[model samples]
Target: MKKVLIVGGVAGGASTATRLRRLNENLEIVLLEKGQHVSFANCGLPYHISGVIENRESLLVQTPEKLKKRFNIDVRINSEVISVDSSNKKVVIRNNGEEYTETFDYLVLAPGAKPLVPPIEGIHGNNIYTLRNVTDLDKIMEKLKEKSIKDAIVIGGGFIGIEAAENLQEKGVNTTIIEAAPSILVPFDSEISNLLEVELMSNGVNLLTNNKVIKFEEKNERVVISLENGNKVEGDMVILAIGVTPDTNFLKNSGINLGERGHILVNDSLETNIKDIYALGDAILVKHFVTGQDVSIALAGPANRQGRIVADNIMKKGKTYKGSFGTSVIKVFSLTGASTGLNERSIKVLGKKYEKMYLHPNDHANYYPGATPISIKLLYEKESKKVLGAQAVGVKGADKFIDVIATVLKFRGTIEDLSELDLAYAPPYSSAKSPVNMSGFIGENIEDNLVEQIFVENLKDFDKDKNIILDVREEFEVVVGQFEHSINIPLGQLRERYNELPKDKEIWAYCAVGLRGYIAYRFLTSLGYKVKNIAGGFKSKLKI
Candidate 1:
């Protein structure tokens, strides 16, 4: 019988062990976990703290006792694998101060990652937490029970930081987020992140952008965090959510090829350098879905998928990992934001030529009673026309649109494929033309050279000496807000008042959204007038 020893028992290891057992009934499988709980939903920790989850036991997926009873696998908790001896195919395991060596015919490493704790002064003080596992959650919850927390300082503006801040605020803590970057959610385009930033501010989050914490000081039973920007923020508690590094330090001399970020380098089959050895999850580097570059997304979904692939490959199933798409979504107050594939920041770094179009469409038919506006951005290669990425923000259905586009991106589908998708439509759910399809329609127009469009970022530096900015929205819409030095000319009145405009000057037409501006552009362009539609429309992009 072939004995398989798997280290770590969270999402990656647990899934791999369970699936592998099902594949081979006679294979001896032993799962080792350093943590007290074998499988638990770490992502739900923040929600539990906010009383949203309401039950602590609900987080447990399959405990070690349950796994042993059901799968007949040797499941051990508090058994930490200390070192690997590839020469004899053995691993040193430590449990309750006792050490033992275990030999295996095949080994899998799914140790996952550890949260990064910035080396700042006084960081080791009381109640400073980094929630990565069940133990961390228990420790933080224990502190909250001991004393009332007045305020919390969350370092880093990524997913964990934002979620923790939101949940902590819900628990009556005056929350603040300090991000070193210029903005939060570094994965998304910074320009597109503007909507989320505004939403955070309006919801009473004290966000300190472009700031770094240099040191921490404890005084009068409180923590004083000093920033590199010469500002000090005093809070009762602190949570370090900067990010995480792969938990593969023990594999340093284990003959494993690690990436630049210390992630175990594995091929498409999730096999390491050594034979009969495999690694997956946050600790392994996977190819980027769009870029095909080695990257560590460190997300739960990718980790689970990699686990299944590892199991299949071990059984000679030959299932390969396509790549990590990095498709993810987050809820901020009433708004939800989602994205997939590579953003402009990443595409530009690779010097890839790509074009983008923006649309502000309702989640459902506008005539529908509970329709909400959704902002969608689509990016595609200028030459190949392949869909590169998308970002969306709205109260409803933002995730659905992004998920639909993400599926198309997985197949290297082009902008035309997006428009051709047979999506379901109804007044309560979607429109005759879904927001995603509308984005495709506009993308097709751009791809086909049917419309000339300019982005707002370029419009600032545009040559104001000649090109005119024209607003094509209704007069009432302009009264609320208008572009600088823009001429108000409704699209409906453009045909009758064609004689009022200069014929030789270039015109830039923009409406509330891009629809009316596109109409005005098509109308004026056919009349021998050089015209361009400002992308994303005015009111939607400018935050009405």
Candidate 2:
């Protein structure tokens, strides 16, 4: 029987072992986990620390005993793979004080990732924590129990940092998030991030942007964070959620090829450079489906998929990895934020030509009492009209909208496909047309030359020039607010007052939402006038 050895036993490794056993019942599978728990919910660590998950045993998805009894797989805990000799197909395993070599015909490397602990002075001192594994969570829980952690400082404004801040605040801890970047959740567009900032701040969580944590200072049994901007923050405990890197140091001399960032290099089949060796999960570099470039994505969804693919390939099945969409979602207070495919910032980095559209629509029918507006941004290739990516942020159903867009991206669906999607809708659940469909409607119009538009970023360039900025809302709507140098001409009276608009220069049209502006754009464009509809209309202006 062929022996299959899997290193690490969380999402990637455990899933691979279980699937491998199910595929080849006679194969000898040995799973090694350096930690105590083999299969546990690592993502729920923050919640556990906040006492939301009252029972620590709730995090354990599966125990070694359960796996061994059910799948007949040998799961060894507290066992570490110190070294790998791929030439001889042997791995040096360390258990207790003894060392042994295990030879395998096929090896799967899923060592996962380690928290990036910077070389800051006093970083190793007590009260500083890095949340990566079960042990880290245990340490945090112990610390919280010992001290009244009123002030908590979280470094990094990524998903983990935001979640940690929210959970800590739920426990009545005064949480502060410090990010070196200018904004939180850099994966999101700045406008959506602005909404997140407001929400986080309103929840009593202090957000410090463009601030760097230089080092830690131990003072009076508390840790003080020293910042680059000459600001010091004292916290009862510090959580470093900066980022993570692939755990590949154990393979430095194992004749394995590593990518630029020390991630294992694997092909579409998850096969490494060495023969009969495979690498999956955060430790491997996979292709970005949109850009067709190799990138490292540390996400559980991709990791789980990679594990299944590896199992299929191991069983002589012709399963191929189609690359990752980098789809991700997170909850912050009341808002649910999610993104898929690519964003405007990523497009800029890749130097790709694309067009973007923004739409603000209720998550469900407006008549439904709890319905909230969902702000969606869609980016598509201008020439092909292909859906490249999308982002949505709102209180309810944000993830669902992003999910639809992600599915469209997977099938390489065009903007026209979005409008034609026959999605189920009802009064309490959704409108006649979903927000995703509305985005497609707007995108198709832009692609078909039916609507000429300008984005918020391009507003400054056009603002300096002499142009007729027309606000198509009602007089009362403008009474509440309007942009500078804008002429208010309600859409109801636009046809009657057609002669009032200047015909020499271009006229930029806007309304409360984008629907009215689109109507006005169609009207003015047909009338032999240079007209451009402002994407997202006045609602976008308010956000900016």
Candidate 3:
């Protein structure tokens, strides 16, 4: 019988074992997990800390007893894989100070990731916590129950940090999120981040951006966090969620090839450099679908898929990993933030040729009672018009929109496909045209030369130069708000007032949304003038 020894047991390892058992019933499968629980929802940790998941047992997806009985797989908890001798096809496991060597025909390494605890002074204090495993959650939960942790300081405003802060706030704790970057959720664009920031602020959660936590100091039973800007924050507890790195310390001398970020290097077949050895989940560095670069994505979705792929390959089937778009979504207060593929920041870093468009449309029809605005941003190749990525932020259905875009990106779908998508729609659920379809409409215009556009960031460059910034909204709308250098010329009067406008200088047209600006662009372009529609229009500008 083929012996498959799996290291670690969570999303990746557990999935691999279960699938492998279904594939080859006679195979000798053994799962070794360092933690007490073999399978649990690590993503649901924040919600559990907030008391939203009142029962701790709810986090346990499957206990060792359940897994063993259901799958007939040997499951050992608290058994850490100390080292792997790939040449000998053996794994050194240490349990309760007793060591054992297990030989395997195929070895799967899913050690997962470790929280990045920066070398800040007093970081090892009792009040500081890092949430990665069940033990971490247990520690935090115990502290919350025994001590009066009325205030919390979460370092790093990524998904975990934001979620942790929100959950702590739900538990009546005054939470503060300190992000090193200029915004929370670094994966998203500035406009989405701005909206999320507003949402967090409105929820009584203090958000501090452009700030770095230098160190933590314990004074008089209070934890004081020192920021780079000479600001100090006192909190009852601190959560370190800056980021995570692959947990490959045990493989230091195990002869497994690691990538630049210390993640295990594997090929399309999920096979490591060592013979008969495989790596998956956060421990393995996989390809980024859009960028075509080996990048580490620690998301659970990709990890689960990688596990399945590894299992298929182990079954002697020709299966390969197609790479990941890094599609992800998170809920912040009332808004849901989601993104897929690359954003402007990534495109700029890669120096790739790309065009972007932002559209502010209601999640559903305006006539719908609870319709909320969804800000959608799409990035596409300027030459090919291929949809590269998209980001959406709104109260409802943001993730659904991102899901559609992610599917389109998977097939290398272009802007034209988006326009022609036969999407299901209704007044209560969606507009006559879905937001994805609207995004396609805008992308199609840019592709067909029907409109020329400039981004909000480029507005500063043209501000100094002489240009006719036309606002296509009504006078009443302009009275309520307008850009500083903008002139109110409603779309209805633009045809008659064309002669009064300067034909020599550039004309940048904008309205409430990009729809009216697109209308103005076609009109001015037909009038034989140098014109560019302000992509995303006034609403986006206001948010930015």
Candidate 4:
């Protein structure tokens, strides 16, 4: 009988063991973990912090006894794999200070990752914690239950940082985020960062960007963070969600190929350089679905999928794993932000020819009681018009937009194809032309040059006098605001008073959103006037 030993028992390891057992009853499967709990709901840890999840036991997916009894798989907790002997196919498993060797025909490594703990003075203070697993959750809960945590300072603005800040706010704690980068959510473009900042600030969460902590000092039950910018901030508790690094230090000299930062290098089938040895999840690097380069993406969704793939390939099913898009969605209180495939930064780094369009569309029909506007930015190949990526933020239905784009990206769908898709629609749920279809429809127009376009963010550098910047909103609507030196010509009066505007100069039109501006652009372009409409019109000021 073939023996399979899996190290680490989170999304990847547990999945591999359970799937392996289901595929072959005769196979010997051993699952070991270095932590007290295995197969817990890690992603739900943040919700539990705010008492949204309520019960701690609900987070536990399975116990060692349950896993073994249900699947007949040998399970061990607090068993750390100290070393790997690839030549002999053996591993040193240490448990309770006892060392033992386990032999295996195949080995899978899902050591996962730990939050990066920088070496700062007083960082080991009792109040500072990093959330990663069930153990970390209990420690945090203990402090919260004992009334030890009051004001919180979360370092970093990535996924964990943002989630922690939001949940802390839910508990009525004064929380502030210290982001080292110029913006939070570095993986996304400025649009998402802009929206996230608004969401956080409006909800009374203080945010400080471009600030790095140089040192930490413990002072009378409070922690002080010294910033490189010569500022100091104090908090009753500090949570470091800076980021994660692969928990694979033991494998450094194990002859397994690792990337520059200690990421295990694996192939399409999730196999390492050593034969009969595989690695998946947060510790290993896999091919990017679109970029065709190796990247370490640490999302539970991809990790779970990787676990299933490893199980199939180990069973000799001849199945190959495709890459991941890193598609993700996060709810920041009431607002939601999501993105799929490559962002602007990734596209620029890859040096590809791409064009981007920004549009603001209502999530549902305007007549609906609770229709909300969504800000969407779509990126595509300049020549082929292939949709590269998309990002959306709104109070509702934002995740749906990104999810649709991600599905289309799996097949390299083009702008025309996306526009032609027949989506379900209703007055309450969506308009006849859904936001997703509207993006594609707008993209088709931009590609065909049916309407010339310029984006609002470029207005800072644009010469107002050189071009006629026309605000096509009704004259009364201009009372709220309008670009300086822009002429007001309502859409209804545009055709009747066309001669009042200068035809010799270039003209840019804008409205509440892009719809009215687009209508004006079509009208003026047919009359043979040099006219373009702002992609996202005057109402997009909120995003900026």
Please name the candidate that would achieve the greatest TM-score relative to the true structure: 1
The clash count of every prediction, one per candidate, is 0, 0, 0, 0
lDDT per residue (tens digit) for residues 31-98 in model 3: 99998989999999999988889898888998889888989899999999988888888988999989
lDDT of prediction 2: 0.88
- The lDDT of model 1 is 0.88
The residue ranges of model 2 lying beyond 4 angstroms of the native Cα positions read 462-465, 542-544
* RMSD (Å) per prediction: 1.4, 1.7, 1.6, 1.5
Candidate 2, which ten residues in sequence have the lowest lDDT sum? 457-466
Report the number of backbone clashes for model 2.
Answer: 0
TM-score versus the correct structure, for each prediction = 0.98, 0.96, 0.97, 0.97
Model 1 scores a TM of: 0.98
| Candidate 2 colliding pairs | none
Task: Give the per-residue lDDT of model 2 (tens digit) for 1-544.
Answer: 9999999998999999999988889999999987888998889988987788989999999999999999999999998999999999999998897999999999999999999888988888889898888888898888877656688999999888899889989988889999999888867888777778889999999999999988898999899999999989999999999999998888999999997779999989999998789989989999999888998889999989989999988898978888998899988888888999888899999887899988889989998888899888889998888999988889988899999988998899999999999998998888998897888888878877899888666677665355888899999888877777888889999999988987888898899778999999999888998988888887776344
Q: Write the per-residue lDDT of candidate 4 for residues 1-544, one digit (tens) a residue.
A: 9999999998999988888988889999999999999899888899999989999999999899999899998889999999998888999999999999999999999999999998877778778999999999888778777566678999999988999899998998899999998889966787666887889999999999989999898888888999999999999888899999999998977899999989999988899999889999999988888888888899999988889989998988866678888899888989999999989888999999988877777888999899998888889888888889988889888899999999999999988878888888989888898887887888888888888788777677567556888899998999999976688989999889988887787888899888899999998888888888887788666354
Query: Which stretch of 10 consecutive residues in model 4 shows the poorest summed lDDT?
Result: 535-544
Return the candidate ranking by lDDT, descending.
Answer: 3, 2, 4, 1
What would the C-alpha RMSD of candidate 3 be, to one decimal place?
1.6
Cα deviation at 454, candidate 3, in Å, is 1.7
Candidate whose lDDT is highest: 3
Q: Sorted by TM-score, highest first, which candidate order results? A: 1, 4, 3, 2
Candidates 2 and 3, the one with greater lDDT: 3
CA lDDT of every candidate: 0.88, 0.88, 0.89, 0.88
